[model samples]
Target: MAVTASGVFRRTAIERADQRVSWERTDQAFFSSGACHVLAWTCRDFYPDQGIALAALYLGDFEHPLHVYARWGRWVFDASGWNLESELLQANSDFEGLPVREVETIRTDLREFCEKHVHRQPHQYWADPTERARAYVARYNPPWL
Candidate 1:
């Protein structure tokens, strides 16, 4: 199948996440393994006026969210573009038998969230996530988008 723009974004985001994790001397795929919040924040920042909210896909235990993505209405956006929520959920077998919860707001403090979940401290480069996200979106944005 032809690669979609969403696919490109997803791959590039994962590559970026991998590079971020590599700084800690590991070779794991952080984006797929645990760092989805980065993409969720990127999506939210890029579409600030779209009423986009965050959602979590629970892991084996319903209490722990294993994945986070952005949702606007019935559409979901992560590293990928806007996709139907049900379809997106169905595409990931990891979510097949799990519960999902829509987060009304990010409860944790931003820096704390990054330190705890993202495993990255605030740096001069990415201290302001909104700026970083905006730059990334602008880099990949097409006129048609």
Candidate 2:
């Protein structure tokens, strides 16, 4: 048996947060604000057959994406966890009544996505994603492991 997409999301989120990669500037849990797109793409890639796609939670304007997460049907997966689309909105007060756009065109390259969308000092996180992931899992020792 293999890990589910939600499992991958949870593990990836926690590990990435723990890694505290250079691009991230947050002391909060979950992924950094600017790393959402990369994290969402990672979750989608981990379960390609699951039809997981990326979606952007925008503020009042569609011109910018305030947050990004993976979506499979009506369910959304983020660093926080798996949640219903409505629940995700309600959980984040800023996005409670905002618009969410399903990203139709996903860039195949992480670097490209960062260059185009990430507002901060965007990083590709491609130096050794698997190795970096392992570093976190080793330190945290999640019970499910």
Residue-pair clashes per candidate: 0, 0
Candidate 2 C-alpha error for residue 18, in Å: 15
Q: Model 2: per-residue lDDT, tens digit, 65-134? A: 6566777777766655556767665545333355444344454465665567643323334243433323
Give me the displacement of residue 83 in model 2, in angstroms: 0.8
Candidate 1 wrong stretches, greater than 4 Å = 1-30, 94-109, 112-145
- Considering summed lDDT, which 10 consecutive residues are worst modelled in model 1? 1-10
Give candidate 1's error at residue 27 in angstroms.
14
List the candidates' TM-scores in order.
0.54, 0.56
Which pairs clash inside model 2?
Answer: none
lDDT of 1 at 101: 45
Range of the 10 consecutive residues with the lowest summed lDDT in candidate 2? 1-10
Q: Give the alpha carbon lDDT tens digit for every residue of 86-132 in model 1.
A: 76665553334543443344556446666655444325222334444
TM-score of 2: 0.56
